[model samples]
Target: MSHADPDQLTLVALGEPAADRSTSDHVRGCAACRAELASLREVVALGRESHVELDLPMPSEAVWDRITAEVDRKNTTVVAVPPHRPRRRVRGLLAVAAAAAVIGAASAVVVDRAATSTPVAAEQLLARAQLSRLGTAPGGARGTVRVVRTGDHAVMRVAVDGMPAPQGLYQVWLYDGVDTMIPLGVLTGGEVEVPVPAKVDLTRFKVVDVSAQRLGQQEHGVSVLRGELG
Candidate 1:
């Protein structure tokens, strides 16, 4: 109410009242909370409108090996390998999962940008702002969607911060001008990576949208955050 709980924010977005009377009362009267709820609702709506489906090619086995190796290198600093008496398997597993989540999250930000606009090299062209401000951090949850082009394909990445992870997995979507939407993929924790489907023309789509999706209702696309591809 006075302060927003991401959980309560979610319930409010779904048009549900909080179970706690005080929280419910606060949400009803708090302008800031209400505005946050509205934004969340809009994102949900955007997800519903997209009808694009991703059929991305997986990285080759050799590529995967390299990726895993890098993952290992990044992970080593986060987790320590223990000596004989006490194995650090649990720590190791958690470290790997965290690294994967970060990678997946960062990759999602990349994909969100690519999906939104016509193919363009990744650059910030704010009317009066410098690009340096846009990327002060490598990948915080609070990143704007960006479109980056590579060879024959475009990638989109949306980085969002503050909101808690969904109960299940978060997903990403692509929306063309005519009310069609596509389910790019499950966001691994904080990021969602979606390759533009081969059948779709990158030049045609103009918006990249991101969302926190619920299971079993795949087609009810709505955007949680969005940016126009330049």
Candidate 2:
């Protein structure tokens, strides 16, 4: 007997009636048709079992605004390249290689911007402070801090000048009026924006501190620059 058509086997695997008696008889007797039907049935069953429904929560307006702004910035910088015409073999290969290089560079720039772009929108300035020298910091070491509240969270934008590069890294911290000091994030010299956790109350953790930290040392490190939110 001849093997059954794939369509007929699919129907039989799905428990639907086959097209005719010949296809049905072929499916019953042919080992190939039976194996194919079994595989199709297993796939169908797995697909049905794996289907899931979920209600995803939407990001806040501030988050959306930041995303829109970054997208706009990227779109503004993008240069549209027109399609090139076909040429001689050697020239065509060179043109393709040049085009690939240009595309790769453009992709790198976009990815860099996306990674470095600030996540929070700087809508309202909550507080400003001039960072004063602390601990073993040089007399010339000075910085400026600006705290902005965007949507449900706040961010501290810090600019440090006249300070020598540290041995390890510069870390930003928020200090409550009491003894509690919360590490916000790491700073990358010049100007760096550090995100404040939503659970942290800005009113309570009003002090902004920049610390010179060693690689493995965790606790507070050594405060190099200190400033109050007000």
Candidate 3:
């Protein structure tokens, strides 16, 4: 009858086992706990779905080992110090704490940068298009596409909604304003990134097309979503 612990509910939402039967029963019966669990699940799903791979710099093992050794030495020295030198001991402890904090902050900075570096670099928007429904698609599906040129590579991010599942798979294509219709990649729905070839000229291939392609089809399929990159 009691409410579930927030920590236990979080763990359960994250696919971890609940702490106890009481927590499990509370989560099942309590509307508030169920809502919180659903919200946490959505957040976890978004985190997993929106993950972008980034090129991150790794700290060397020797650097970590040295930090560990230094901390160990400081701890040992602190403990061995006599009570007569209380002021000196306090100063030493404070210095060690400060060093640890600095190291932790630096490590956190590196990790945060590595996680967010890709999106920042890829945010140089080159072109954008509002994808409109084409042909006799059942739903009033709408989407937006953004093309970004990061360094030598170009990336296209697409977000679509109200799209009913196709018979086969949805594939993205790029047209080079001529006879060439280059296939970028397959789309899984919601939001997806399609990598454009670095050598491909975006000026020529300005058309972004999302098509429903049948299995084993080598040619360009029916265009469901169409947009022109400006």
Task: Tell me, by TM-score, which candidate is best.
Answer: 3
What are the models' TM-scores? 0.35, 0.46, 0.49
- Model 1, 1-230: lDDT tens per residue? 13656545544554445646877777778888778667666544433333422222333444344336545664554322222211122223223333454556668878998898687555433211001112222343353555555666655555556446665455666668577877676666455445657676545665555565666666644445555555
Give the residue spans of candidate 3 off by over 4 A: 1-122
Summarize candidate 2's per-residue lDDT along 64-115 as a digit string, tens digits: 4433443344466532222222222212222233333355566888999999
Candidate no. 1 TM-score: 0.35
CA lDDT scores, all candidates in order: 0.51, 0.68, 0.68
Write the number of the candidate with greater lDDT, choosing between 1 and 2. 2
Q: Model 3, 179: alpha-carbon shift in Å?
A: 2.1
Candidate 3's residue-wise lDDT over 1-230, tens digit each?
45566545544554657756877787778898899778655544443332322122332444344335545763654222222322223223333333454556668889999888875454588899998899756567988999887877779999888888888888889986569899988889577998888887878888988888998888999988888999
Candidate numbers, best lDDT first, in rank order? 3, 2, 1
Segments of candidate 1 deviating more than 4 angstroms: 1-142
